[model samples]
Target: MYHNTKLTGMVVYPNDPEYQQARMNWNPFTNAFPIVFVFAQKIEDVSNAVKWARENKVPIRMRSGRHALAKDFSQTNGGIVIDTSHMRNVTLDKKNGIAKVEAGIRVGQLVRMLAREGILAPFGDSSTVGIGGISTGGGITAIQRTAGLISDNILAVTLVDANGEVLQVNACENSDLFWAIRGGGGGNFGIITSYTFKVRTAPSKVGIFEIIWPWNQLNEVIDAWQRWAPCVDVRLGTILEAFSKANGLLHSQGIFLGPAAELEKLILPLTNTGSPIKVFVDEVTLLEAIDFWAPNEPLFDTQNTTWSSTWVKSSLPEDGIAAIRTFLERASGSESNFFFLNSGGVMNQIPPQETAFFWRNTRYYMEWDASWTDKCETQKSIKLVEQARLQLKPYITGSYVNVPDLNIKDYGQEYYGDNFERLRKVKERYDPENVFNFVQSIPPAHICDEKDIDD
Candidate 1:
């Protein structure tokens, strides 16, 4: 029913030589085959593609860096994929301290680009993740405690709705849509073509530290971290990762906005209690620290094939650190790990109702993940992740939308909390037909009974 001749963008069909390259996602576990992949080079091209999909009654999947953990939301079988990978362009208004970034630009590329101009934007830890996806889903980074979430810096967004109408959303214009897209998660409201963000001056130097403790010291190290990291100087942010017994690694890493001496003094409590095997702390340029936190990966290399089927569940760690230790003890895969991201300071300053991201008061955000190479080990890895989620449920406040898990039964309430109704209303306003939909996407509230909701 769809015709390639009617499409404006570069369309790659199944028979095209570059179809597989265009359709590949970061997660190899995704088996969905798109009917066609449209590489949108301009905003008009995106609008044209959306119009084409609507006229042909085809499901549309919007993709940028293709790093979505829940690939079902970014790819679809027998559906059209409107990929914005070709629309990467970044412009900065140095005088105004604002940057206009295209949707397809990777976070690492943006960081490097911004660094050249002595500017910085808040982003996730992954170098290859698309700014479009992360910023729309409340991007958390090493500097979040100091700088706030990536969404918080967003001044405006240009989106193409289901009707193929291009609308610029900001505080003064299309204000409601602006609020929803800030942290409502991507591919729900519409296809965001570009974002205008309020950027900050990059610090001349930042302190970076890494301390590794043996598995036996997990409890002591984690307890120290929970008590100290979140409440430390707002200029500091930390992450704790507990690798499986197969890897036998428990490490705590952080970046501080000030010099190494200040960071050393503040982190003394963490260093003294854990009996760490190795501890390294030093001051480096902001760019160097960013690279240290998240190293870059080759964008189009499928030969090595690093594939992971991941399930993530998040919560505020109160009494859950012990349960996390138990899960890590029982973890079986070579790459299974439990990650905790320190969340307080500037991140907590934002009230929960301001944006769709509701876990503002959380001290630390925890994630349980499993990764494997062999398909034969898939079941075991997924089961481990599931078991960890079930055990930690009692201690967790809610889950993060960026690290999505299909196993979540009440995804809307769990991800958005009390903000689901407002998000649904926005979805209804922008996409009344529900053309932009996925397994865990917000459904318009009028369609579902309010009594059925348990948030």
Candidate 2:
């Protein structure tokens, strides 16, 4: 491959001293080494890197915060890595209630920046996660029930296509690409350089609550939570986590866009289910609540930590509470847990066809995750996740794209549902050669024959 000396960003080869540090990801479970790593400083630098990769016949993997659960999606054995971590510019329009944020900014930075202006954008729970990954995958946060997913608040996007052409996509221009990018998942479409988001006024005071029960009451607490949380006031967003008995606790926590007294009254059903060992509720500013929920963390903080492989599967809980309890009873390690994210309110107000995100009608988004420290326990832990999935298969309809799972066979329907074909068409139009593709990416429509399309 011929190197381009005119490129604006710094490019590092295997021999470079910085190469080792540049290729590392947040998750230590998988190892990815690329032929070249380009630290993009500007939008034009991304374009130049893409053109260089195409000419060299090398695969290109776009990375932002590098927090992807499915590590393989953002890594290639011997390809080019286009990292956008250096482009962290954010411009705000307070009067217009809009913010133009670069792809490299972390969710915590975006949240704090907006908080300074008494405004906010819907973001995920993890502060270290990248905005580019979350927005594209339909981000859900504590205020999601009120404000909707992060993707829903996006006004427009500036993308650099596979051919290295700059494209401005929005409702009025490049509408198909615009529609696909929102909740269509990243790494399938072009690289998003920046996002224009519609911001909302931050509430003066919000309620933050956490309640914990003994493991013996997991079933009762989960049942009460599922019936109450999703049907509560749209202003409240909550999550329930049932940890393994080794952890010895079942907890429910969330944020409410109101005072603590009002939030307590609404969540009484959950708190009253079992003898709660601990209960805490307080009224604080939105920023205070966010910090309490997910504290700010360093970017590359995973080294020397106990590396664990994680598998996640999502579903809409129905009559599966008993199955979930049974699965947890036979779970493998202390790190294993099951989570349910309340998902009604404004999220269900939008029709599924309105965007590529098709799980609007689900009451709650559920995830079953298992982690292990030792290599000997890896397969056993993964098997536990798979077994739990099999038990809940009769009730689950789809999975979340943010928590990608390679174990899924029919990923197209599982992730995109009926919108898969349309996404495929959009992929053909934007990346005809499948330049931006990976294991679970939307394949170009032409590549799938009639038989595969029918399936």
Candidate 3:
């Protein structure tokens, strides 16, 4: 009956000349050889791809920017990848202070477009991460404490459900679905085509700061940052990173919605905590700050990347700091490091259980990133991150669904917290057949009760 929704996307099969480029994933460590790839250009293209995959008995993997962090999350061997990468479009409503953004638009492109109009929203550090993933996964950014998460800003979404039916989800309609989509993770309940987000006018100028210290200052820097970052002024949002010993550096940077002198005073405790080799502070327009944070060229060019993130409820103890030093000392790859995105302030003002993003009260977000240029070092690189995660397990509780780790035993609870059960119920209501299945996807209540046989 729905055959009229024919597949109109550009399909690239295994034999296609561009197949290699088409199949590349952001985390090359988890690359897959899908049977075919569909670069969907419109909502009809997405609907047809989903229906065709179901009819053909081919597993479906919905990808926004190929940035899924774990194995088989966004790409699957012998299955079809229905990608929204080509569907970049946007409609701004300055009157309502909102925007209708296509799911496939990259963060950098979207930020630039909004900056041109003197508006912006909460976004992640990597300019290449797709808006669909970042928004649904609960975006992290330098302005999070001041602006709130990207999901918190979402007003509505137009998504195609697993049954080839498009639904409008928002606060007043399909409200349960809206709550689940906010932070339940991307490509879970459905494939969102576009999102209506609350956008704010960009500040003409904001203070930015960057500081670096010698590798030996790891303990001092982490101790100072974790103690100060989450409690600092509400106008500031920052990140602390400890590079591998081979790299020999500790970097901290942030965006402050204030003047340079004001930020300088706020960060004095941190700047004075450790012996910093480089310290710089300046005031720039919001657009300039975005550019300063982003890479000059497009991102996702790195290969063989392994990444995972967790919710930090409290400060990491001294033992935790030592563990990081120990791991970096012998980490196999030069790209291994620890990343901490500040939390608290306005972001934590919202209570948990309000939305699917249950880690609203987290002190900070921690991530382990490991990369290797040589393929032979893959296991070593991944293991280094794994070892680090195990060491910090006591200090960290939940994991970010965006940076999935297959090694986690019970991912449902880890990712969704108590909201996991609620998410399952929503899944049953919208996708009783469990059509959108991934490695760590939330299974409907029926499937959880052992009444199902296949994914």
Which candidate should be chosen as best, given TM-score against the real structure? Answer: 3
Candidate 2's TM-score reads 0.93
> Each candidate's TM vs. the true structure?
0.93, 0.93, 0.96
lDDT, candidate 3, 79-128, per-residue tens: 98999989999999998899999999988889878988999677677888
Candidate 1, residue 384: how far the Cα is off, in Å:
1.7
Worst 10 residues of 3 by lDDT: 446-455
Best by lDDT: 3
| lDDT agreement with native, every candidate | 0.81, 0.81, 0.86
Provide the lDDT at 128 for model 2: 89
Worst 10 residues of 1 by lDDT: 303-312
Worst 10 residues of 2 by lDDT: 304-313
Instruction: In model 2, state the lDDT of residue 204.
Output: 95
Q: Please, what are the lDDT tens digits per residue for candidate 2 over residues 177-288?
A: 9999988998888999899998889999989999999999977888788778778999988988898777888988988888999998988897778899999999998889
Predicted structure 3: lDDT: 0.86
Which residue pairs does candidate 2 place in steric collision? Answer: none
Instruction: Report the C-alpha lDDT of model 1 over 375-437, residue by residue, as the tens digit.
Output: 776777676677777776666677788888777777787788899889999988888888898
